[model samples]
Target: MGVPFEDFKFNRQILNAIADAGYTEATPIQQKAIPPILNGQDVMGIAQTGTGKTAAYVLPLIMKLKYAQGENPRALIVSPTRELAMQIEENIKTFAKYTDLRVVVLYGGLGPKTQIEQVNRGVDIIVTTPGRFMDIYLAGHIVTKTLQVLVLDEADKMMDMGFMPQINRILEVVPVKRQNLLFSATMSDKVHSLSANFLEFPTVIEVTPQATPAQTVNQHLYFVPNVKTKINLLKKLLDAEDDVKKLIIFCKTRTSAEDVYKFLLRKYGENGVKVLHANKGQNTRINSINAFKADEVKILVATDVAARGIDVSDVSHVINFDVPVVIEDYVHRIGRTGRAYQSGEAITFCTPAEEYYLDKIQKLIKQTIPVSDIPADVFVEATGFDERQEQAREIDLQKRKENPDFKGAFHEKKTLTQRKKFDAAKAKKTGQQTDKRNKSPKAYRKKR
Candidate 1:
């Protein structure tokens, strides 16, 4: 049998909170990372999403903090995205419900006045994105000297979003002697470098291989020819009677997300669908997420920004409307489902152009996604000229990337055309010079 929470020896308050949250057994990450964290050691946890890594650290921190302290925050958790920061704050609130510890969340894309006021009122724990945290720090509204614990959640994502400079600044400003915790799904070189700079003799805990998807997620891929065909396939899948209570369709760009959202909206009406992307306002994004979480919307079409930190449990299906260009994001995207040991499905639609990215994603995850034929009910449309050209160009680019000396068909044709023009121009110039030199005496005299 799995180890129970009681074996961890948490205080009564924490144990009660855990029970209230409906958790009895500890996940592997929680069982392993909690002890070292509670022991006041710096920790570097390498685990993918849906592994209860958040609680692994949050529980220990709550147990250590116990109750309210001075006006300044004693612990700070920096997340890569606003959604993630908010999610962490919510988790902290749930686990710290019995205690008097005050928690505040800070992120960008909204007014800072309210956040600044919350900080002014004093908080025990601050969960924020690196940029917003730095903004408040620079504004002199925060006191980092009193910080006892610093956690960088999703450290790899922070590096990917180009927040390393802000992270470095925050690290420099915070007290040098403090308990530091770094967590990430993948251990890229940048994450490694950041860990070396931030963590001091950390107890490295890796519960699973880097970039690996959750075992509960059954992954499938479809080789679609074009966008319309993909849409047709999506329609067929959604129309089926399988368990699709909650679904998230991930698109690579806002335009694609909007397109998918429109299609779904027309079919299912606004009540059944919502869209989220960077183009949407902060309130709209938050509302979309809230609606999805509350089960008011059956489908959410989103970009990669929503892939990393969304924590809606029992997400029945995750569909890749567009293959993520960033291969590492594949793990996080599918992680939205199959949470808390529940079985879920992840379906990817791969156009010819997207196959390159798919290959990279498969390599990163260290497993081949099982390929399946398009459903017989789905109508496969003919590929359009523009789409075909785009796929060809993408394939050519991939070839060039692999072999620098390789010249694609388009490039070779263009080069041949340019050479013909150059040869014609040179021949014309040479003929003109010869004509001038071989001019008749009368013509030459007349010219002189």
Candidate 2:
């Protein structure tokens, strides 16, 4: 109601494309951020993931390019991860399907020669991770001097991954006078300070509270004893619940993700589970995502890198296999489910070490999660418990050795349940020996 479709110079083709994509009303961030973006004004948008921030910028970029002539990279967008960069590219292609704007994605894990070929052929838009962008830019493969627009998506994550130094270097290479757009799910002090350096009197747009998790997700927290106990608890939940359609289990690192994925497969079956992480090749990651979306796989285990920009709805559950260190990451991981007004559940396994992280996440989401208690009947053998836990740890360690970039160092927090069972067995044996030694002569005669 605020702005008619005719008000913006959006071609009929783009309008039809948007309608085809099942989008009618613009989301709050889209409505507010799009106008200034079309006007070539710098914009600082504070919005969480899944709020259509991608469209907020993509539509305007395509509109601007409709009039601009040469395709020597007029728009440059920098994302923190390969998946996110690919997602931005996908959104641009979807929105600009009818337009003539050429979009290309550049990220690590793949060779740069292919990206260089795309750039040489002339691209209107380039979506890339900061490292890859800088790599090619410094080599003079990309002509940043002619860049008309620059966007930094997921700015906070970029800073978190230590991309600021590279970003500064990229900024120095690109032309200073250009339309700048900065978008982040949360506005940390570093993000605010980074915005100060780029945006010039920009229009600020915020649809959701900073670092706030979605309301549609029903969150549940379980206080478990340790890593092994958490695995057992998860197995119980999986076996007991009949309604679980699909799961995206999030670990803090690629190592933990793979380990959890392997454990689920070994415990459940190979047909039901798959793992996605940065260590996986581009084709494998993409194929795994597609398989999960198609319901070919019931469980998709992944790290925080998979949290952003992997959009698949109808996900019945999101399991925090390990509590994320970053509070915003908790929001992002849970966001994989409960999308498009559909209700979903998010379950987190928190050990004593992760309790503080859960507290921070609760504050970030502005609500206390209802605690879920594990039913008391499940049991593990006393003496075999340590051997089982030790074996699991060994497998996880071996996985880390194979993939060095795994990010979940704290997932290895030792739990008390394993130790408690050992202590109880030892105490019972001691008591039995003492009773035998203290038997009276009358008791011995009665036994005879």
Candidate 3:
């Protein structure tokens, strides 16, 4: 608690809202980004999720747009996903409770009628996803000329989701001289390119290294042999650990998430388990997230889409049921816990096939995840032949990626032998033909 929010000298309305939200001290990002944002400078912020980064820029934007102005929105915030867009809207509403600021959230999957109505009623702030924002804008429902500030939260995710074209289109339509704020967990090359094109001589603030997890999370890794063993280990942990009051299990795909959800449901019943993924309906996904946040569900299984936006502060554990292929997602997945300076645990299950991704994640985060043995009571299942072969192939692929000359177990010896024989035969035939051609015409006739 270095500096209290009151020290920032925000207006009375903003201060009151902050107090109502139970926020006193500023986080590191807020401390570094607030001043520059208040001064109306373009800012590029690199910080992990759950780092109070939303308020870092949001608070200042609120302070700058102190009062409701013209009919059109004066500030615009673009997020990568619908969940994150809603979360940002919620944050703005929390901090703007004492003011007359009107915020409208826009995203796809839901009809645009209500969103259009909200915008038509007149808004001061528009928090939206790139696609829906463009949709409503192109439909002539949104006014961008009056937009004073533009914020791109989760900039890296936006790049990953291929929203660059929409973002570039939006940038072209909006006022070029307005304040620009970009926040991302990692500063990848794509993110840097976006920042260079969007922000102008921006104040760059980095609270931590790129792709690093929060320090408050105690991380551990378990090397499981196969999927069945991974499930067995999950059940064993849930049954044995008394401290897992609230947990989010992250999977790599929707199908895997659904499988884990069904497993947990059968064991813990529907009341205790809920699943969230793109396959679920929008309302169901929202309900599942809400239930988990309210502590009504002991376990929530989800994919990486929920990793960045879930703001539950007391999540006791984050279990990576599948090692994320996208290495940066590992940071976001573990970030769901250990939020708001609270201590939490992150446990990851890595199968042999996923070891390659695990290695990349470890290198990206710049830390070796502590490996722990399976509990003695848990039954360790034997790896089947198919799974063993798959693991071997994956290992060989990883090695060959490191050294292209290295031959893998899957490399066909028969093909190599056949190639050698064919090459020798071809060389011998070519040599004989060359000898015949080299012989003089008279020598050839004498031999005949």
Pick by TM-score: which candidate is best? 1
Please write out the lDDT profile of model 2 over residues 1-448, one tens digit for every residue: 5454445668887898888887777777888988889888999998877777888898888888874357588889999998888888888888888877788899988889989998888888999998898888878888877788999999998988899999888888889899999999889999999999998998888888887777788999888766777778788888887988989999988878877888888876867888898888999998888888888988999988889888786898999989998878998899888876678899998865566678878898788899977778544323256654654565456457658775333363544566656655665565532234643222112345
Residues 1-448, candidate 1: write the lDDT tens digits.
6689999868999899999999999999998999999999999999999999999999999999999999999999999999899899999999999999999999999999999999999899999999999999999999989999999999999888999899989989999889999999999999999999999999999999999899999999999999999999999999884789899999999999999999998998989999999999999999999999999999999999999878998898999999998889999999999999899999999999898999999889889999999978889999999889888999999999989998997897899899867765676565532244643222122355
Off by over 4 Å in 2: 1-8, 267-270, 380-448
What is the TM-score (0 to 1) of candidate 3?
A: 0.90
Give per-residue CA lDDT, model 3, range 184-251, as digits (tens): 99999999999888999999999998888999999999999898999999999898889987999999
What stretches of model 1 exceed 4 Å from their correct place?
A: 416-448
Listed in order, each prediction's TM-score against the native is 0.92, 0.82, 0.90
Using lDDT as the measure, which candidate wins? 1
Candidate models: Cα lDDT each: 0.92, 0.82, 0.90
Give candidate 3 regions above 4 Å deviation: 389-448
Residue clash pairs of candidate 1? none
